[model samples]
Target: MQSGHNAMTGFVTVILALVIVIVGLVSRWPLWVWPFAAGVLSTGAAASLVRARRRRPLIPPERLLEPELPIPQVERWECVIKDVSLPSLSEDYDFQFSATVRWLPQEAPPNAPVVNAGGLAIDAVVDRARRITHQSPPHRSSLVQHRLNGELATMVADPSGRVLAMADNVRLTLADADRERLEKLATVRKNEEVWEHERKWEQSKRAYLGEDVLRTPGSAVVWWLAKNDEKIDKTVSDIGLLAELSSAANDQSVPDDFQRYVPGLAKEQEPLEAMADESTTGPPSPDEYARFLLRHSGLPDGDPRRALYLERVAEAAKGAGLPDVADALLRMLGDFPHPPQSAGPAEPPFDGYFDEDPPYDD
Candidate 1:
């Protein structure tokens, strides 16, 4: 508007200047007046020309067809599926899953069939998680949940490509009862391992005793000396007892080499001459048999060793189911006399002798 007004004012000024020039000429004005008029006409013309050059030409009205509408955009939506039950590798056990899911519907051609976008998104996310959970044990739900979180954090195009789905804050859980059962099972497995190891140790110990340490009286003595190097005398004294224990453990009689150390043992091994005598008036009674065995023990009357021998024989008779003979021998042992005080402190009885009886009676 301003440029057009300036152009009109300049045109008016030029017209006025031209009229003055023409009137001055027709009226025969002074030459100075003509120069002034010429200057005015020049100024007006210059202004008009400058204004016309600065003015912008009108732009034709743009074609007014309605603005083309942007293709309607499909907005992404969010759906949360919580407490969904999923199967696990363990029988009768299921995983509980929950997640916040976001998805976008795929661009479809016109006349496309209607579909459930939210349902498809949920199914896609759940199915993707199930693929992992189904292969995992119920007790490993936390680990599987971690894996699912990483996988579902990124958007994935569904198999049908109808929608893109992603998930966050994923969770998986197992029943408390199942978790407890797994813990107990693990404990039992560990206990079973311990028991197996203990059993093996016990068997090894038995084999060592039977096959190595106690194989014979000599081996037994060697083993005892190795353990008690300073107890040599004690070891020698206990050799007979060790032999007896070893024989008992192996279910055998004492070795002949050791029989002399155990009084009454050699006599027991020999057949009774009185029993074989055809002229014998009758079989000896328990008392007579006990006295005969005592006499053959080779330990003299009033000797502490004799009492020890009697005690051992009684124990053996009792073990052999001869209760009457055992009783008779015990009575004889109780009646056995002790040596005079002048004998001094009697030598300590050997390990196998006088186990329950005093070396001397008071």
Candidate 2:
């Protein structure tokens, strides 16, 4: 647009100049049509300039990328397993999931062991997203978590099923099967958590003194999602893998009464289920949970009381919904060391709000 406007302006200026010259030359060529001569010169110059500008393409013409051909509608023929041939990527068996399938979930690696959708075995290879079904498990919902564990030879169409390519990422997914597993595991996990929380003080104090960690499920997926704690010092991280867990959970829709019907799960972590939906920022633990605490504390870098604030001040941040406060307090230990004189217990764990970030209301 700018170029065209400049061209038009230049053309008009040339014409004006020609008119002036013609008027000046009229005195010399009294009988000649000076205006005609001026018009011709201006028209020629403007035409040539406009033509030249159009010949140059704006941005380089991009090569035409081939679009994928639509998949043929299979007539649904039952080809009995005369010889069932599945897709395999490497003869030496090196699984490569370098890139993830765009349609498949990118939250976790598309591996069988990770998802186990619909209760399929760990060795299942997902060729494509087939169908999702909600069958009840033997006692509850029929949930099987399935994931792929190897590089997949993807079927790219060339009119016929002749050309197959190994995509950088496998299309591993957890359909209804996987979701069922996650929900069930979550219930069992909740049960374990409640058991542990009932005795976390005993567990942590003992571990702090000498005994080994009480060894709960660690619920890696739970923390991976809602870890507002410091990732630097935390054992788990946002970058870590929960594709296995997430894929399984996402594959199926949670039962309408998932929380209610899920016997032990929703019961165990009532605070978490009630406080917030699972996110990439769950609670923190002892190991590296402290580091995550530092990041969320919003204190100045290297605050002297940060450790004490986390360890001593934030202990007040606890109640029915706080399963991960330990890491928060420990991370902010340097900020608030000693609690207020009349803030309840003097040597309490951490002293401020439980459901919210610290400093306190009263």
Candidate 3:
């Protein structure tokens, strides 16, 4: 408040000084005397206002108290029955016991139980029924609760009384809130497992299959030299032969024999060599031709071939521990590319069932 008053006093003093100067210059009527008097009065008023405001304490704005959020309440009941009053046990008693349970989906619908209590156990299905009703974990987070939720709603009763088996086989009917919380926990656990699997897959990506096969000709043969029943001979398979047939080294087009086998693919050797040799293509080519051989080499068409290929692939995979690389090559061979003419959108088959069928009347 004092600072505001001081500012107003200073503004007035400046205006008065300007007026006095103008009057003195135009009419020489003691304007300088007016400015001095105005300046002194304004200075005194501004200082007094500033001092008064400085002595007072500042007041803060008042705020309203916010309301508290409502809490959810659920009802629970527990009764202890200690009074034992009964008619004579010699007569058959028609005791009733029932239990209802549903953990997931469409469970058996709930029904009442008719219990017969003979002396002793009496194979108590009704008693079992009651046990079923009360079997789930009280905290309701255990596997026991989930298991019970998925069973038949049943009963067993011995007219002869049995102690409650409170430790197992019962579940609570979840109200909306509790069910939502439990299901959320299940979802979180599922996502964590998925994330863990995804991480393992990613970590295993770089050196996945075929890394060893890239080193030399018939390299899978060289890499798995240690662990073979007899030996995995690259000489036995046509991988080397196919490579030579398709090699960019061949000045001619792919041979007819190669065409007969792989059709659209020029024996795995041709376009592959062109793409593979990093030295020929550049410092870093797309992939090595040997890599294709490693992948496509292990998959034979028939039983004996498939058997042989699996043997080789297993050995190579173990030796190199590069399943990822082998996988890429295997995928390429299995998913051979098609020419535009043969690969265009397929035509839908035509059928005229209505013309050959009975009239529309029904």
Candidate 4:
């Protein structure tokens, strides 16, 4: 557009100068008037073009980047199957196991596992998390409370399925079939995650177009897509194998009520139900419960009172017959040492929101 304007102004300047010279020669006006007029007009046109050029954007407006959208939160269910013990009380049994689950109950934050405490931000987080359901990928939901040994232990799931709480010799007996079933479920879930990641990586390759793909005559482009495709295929193959194994172990369909983010994770609810039995002892104190909830939260970098509070909480858990919880607390006392005073009830565990820089060739 600037170039077009400059060309038109130059053409006009030439025509005006010619007219001025003709008119000056033909008219009774002084000859100096025409030269003066042409020079002034030329100077004015040059000045205008220079000003317009300075104002023009170097890159087209459409090509300039818009405000970057917040990184999309990929909902993911991070399940950790810590320990599998054998035998339900019955001769015939289904799979039962102890596991920790971290539900990203929402679209997930751009900087998840560490969201802002502001009111609007909190609302958005809650809204996202509430959309959680059984069929969603990247399952996000609430924490699971179960008994580790005799103690009531509340655990927020971590991505790496480590035993968040367990006594030295506390084993929940499960039948051989149950153990096999749980193992199969674990295999399926793990491979499913791998498959999803591989699929996303493959999709990211499509972002390149125009000269990016054509510049090198498809040398790097072919290899790049092929490599990702191979990864995708391998993951799919692994998932198929695991799924077949799972189907072989239990041909029966999972009941509708039994649906959970991670299959078999609903089994954790069994203990909670048992705890509710009138014969069972009482629940943990509010403070003990509160402390357990906080452990799952990503603590701030530093704070002074964390050590003292953790010591008190550990003592409370041990008193409540949850040595596993106490021990877990001891291990983590040094791990996320600082919890903000207003951190409140810990939010459900979520995938950490790092910027998505899919490793792909451009």
Candidate 5:
């Protein structure tokens, strides 16, 4: 059928060209004009014919195409109860148990080994939930908390696979103060982690964009180093881990030989003197103050103040729902000569959600 169509098209093109020549001759056109018009028409017709010849389909759409199958849609719950509470009698003799579960958009670490308590993986889920909630950043902490709560809210079974009372709408409420504290913690942890990560990343960049590269004037290496220096400086400023340097500057700690070699020592003296005169009101709570000291402490490990700082910081960390940090600070006291029992195991978990820190036990 295509061949027949092409033949018909060719015949029509020939008839049109003949008519054009006839009209040109009847009008007494120049001899050169007749040949030129015929040549342009013939060339255009040949090109069109060639293009038509080359336009064959490699595979016919109707022949090669297959019908698309409908995709199967699966209905998923907003939250799924991963584990139910083990059956146990309450003080009032009623069946009692809780569950550890996960919410939708589940991206938490896989649940750990289950401790069999009436066939319910209570311990495993609980531990996993703990790990998820342990994230330090405020926004991330809140998100993880929500996810944990979602998992917990969906619990509908007892340890023996028996259905328990389930709420139609599980809504966990938090007081404003409690919410604020969590947000503060999460933000602090996030910033601290980012500062640490960026610090390490800056160190790693030095291998490629070190001082030696910066010394190469007008080169690509020099440009690269300059660009990276801005980022490195910003990270350093944000982390603000310059307490040691600042302390040294303020204390006239530089040796004579170092002063002779290093410039700007004399110029910094006025500012240092001014800073020494300004007094701070100190942090609000012992915990907040302790954290400040922990971050800003510039004392040497063997200095007497080092142990004092750590001790105070540990107290503050514990009060701030930062048991891990507090424990770490306490471990730093191994070198100090205090009573054997002072360095005993950690205090028990804080009593209620909003409970005040109990008096520090020796």
Candidate 6:
């Protein structure tokens, strides 16, 4: 409107300038009048040129006929939710969560229903975090918090798609007392597992010894041989003691075949005259006692029992600080016969002991 008014005024001024020039020529006006007319004409021409340059171009009818794009309407806001308590996997335990939530409402039509974007954002972020915390124990709140920070760091649209929300600086925690209790409980559970393992090991050991190794004198001999195959001589010498120990453990008497090897059995059957002779001699030497015991046992010189009885006397001599007597008895054992070979298949190398039922009834 201003540009048009300026153009009209300039046109009128130009016409007046033309009339003045014509009148000056026709009526013999003064030279000053011509300069005034010329000045007026130049001013009008400048005004018209300014208006024409400033004018906007006209739009084509087809351009106006095209459809116009709708402008998007987005509402963005932020809020801080503090001390939000959420349940955890454990009963009587909850996670305390706090974070800054930023929300961006999705673009909708002008007639779309309006909703509380801030509340939706808070609910979406809190609910998403709650799902993770609910599956995690109270003691693992820090770990769960780390996971939430990663998951909620990005904007995620709500289920209804009305708003997108994101969380930052997420903090999940448990009460001091609850955290301490959980730590102690974890320690206790770990110790319980160790204790259970040790208890099982002890039970297995007892079963192996009671039912397999020491079930009988013969079984004890075989088990000892499996363990100390290189010490065959020593095993043969300890056979008497092993048989005695096995019998005592089972609350049974030593087998008759092994009675001669056991000192307790041989001593009970010794004659009074022999005891008197030992009294008369004050006390027999270790070698003499070994020979006497072997004779009373009725075991032959090459019998393993002879070596076993001699070894027992040798151990007694050593305990009594008689090295010379012990050496003599050991030399006697060396002269004894080697153990008989088995006619059956050779036993496998001993890896470890295992439990099994005893061969005989209790």
**Relative to the true structure, how large is the alpha-carbon lDDT of every model?**
0.81, 0.41, 0.43, 0.48, 0.50, 0.81
Sliding window of 10 residues with minimal summed lDDT for model 6 = 349-358
Instruction: Tell how far residue 135 is off in model 4, in angstroms.
Output: 44
Model 2 CA deviation exceeding 4 Å by range:
1-17, 25-29, 32-164, 167-178, 200-362
Q: Write down the RMSD of candidate 5 (Cα, Å).
A: 32.8
Best by TM-score: 6
TM-score per candidate, in order?
Answer: 0.50, 0.20, 0.19, 0.17, 0.20, 0.53
In order of lDDT, best first, we have 6, 1, 5, 4, 3, 2
Per residue, candidate 6 scores C-alpha lDDT tens digits across 1-362 of 55676768777876887787788889998887788778867887777778776876587545665457676887559999888999999998888999999999898657878889889899999999988888987888878999999999999998778999999999998988888888899999999999999999999999999899999999999999999999999899989999998998898878767877798777643443355676664655555555555556767545676766776667767777788777877877888865666699975533333447435656
104: Cα error in model 3, Å:
32
Please give the lDDT score at residue 124 for candidate 3: 35
Off by over 4 Å in 6: 1-76, 108-113, 270-362
Runs off by more than 4 Å, candidate 1: 1-74, 109-112, 262-362
Per-residue C-alpha lDDT of model 5 across residues 1-362, encoded as one tens digit per residue: 45775797789788989899789878989878977887888887788777777787667767774658576897432323432322111121111123423222222235644433323433344444444443423334335445655655454444333223222232223345545766787799999999999999988786444334322222332354356676865533322122223334345344322332234543333333334554543214333333345535876444666777687767667787777767767765666655334576876654444446555669
Off by over 4 Å in 3: 1-130, 133-156, 159-172, 209-362
Cα lDDT tens digits for candidate 1, 1-362: 55667768777886887789679879999777887777867786677777776876565336334567467787659988888999999878889899999999899768888888788888999999889888998878878999999999998888778889999889888878878998898899999999999999999999999999988888888999898899899998888888887887787778768875665575543334556673664566788788678867776545777877887788788777888999999988778754334556766533444567757777
Tell me which of candidates 1 and 5 scores higher on TM-score: 1
Among the numbered candidates, top lDDT falls to 6
Over 194-294, each residue of candidate 3 has an lDDT whose tens digit, in order, gives 99999988656524422443233335334444345365463344444443443333334444344433334544445455656656755322234334554
Cα deviation of 286 in candidate 4 (Å)?
Answer: 99
Better of 4 and 6 by TM-score: 6
In model 1, how large is the Cα lDDT of residue 138? 83
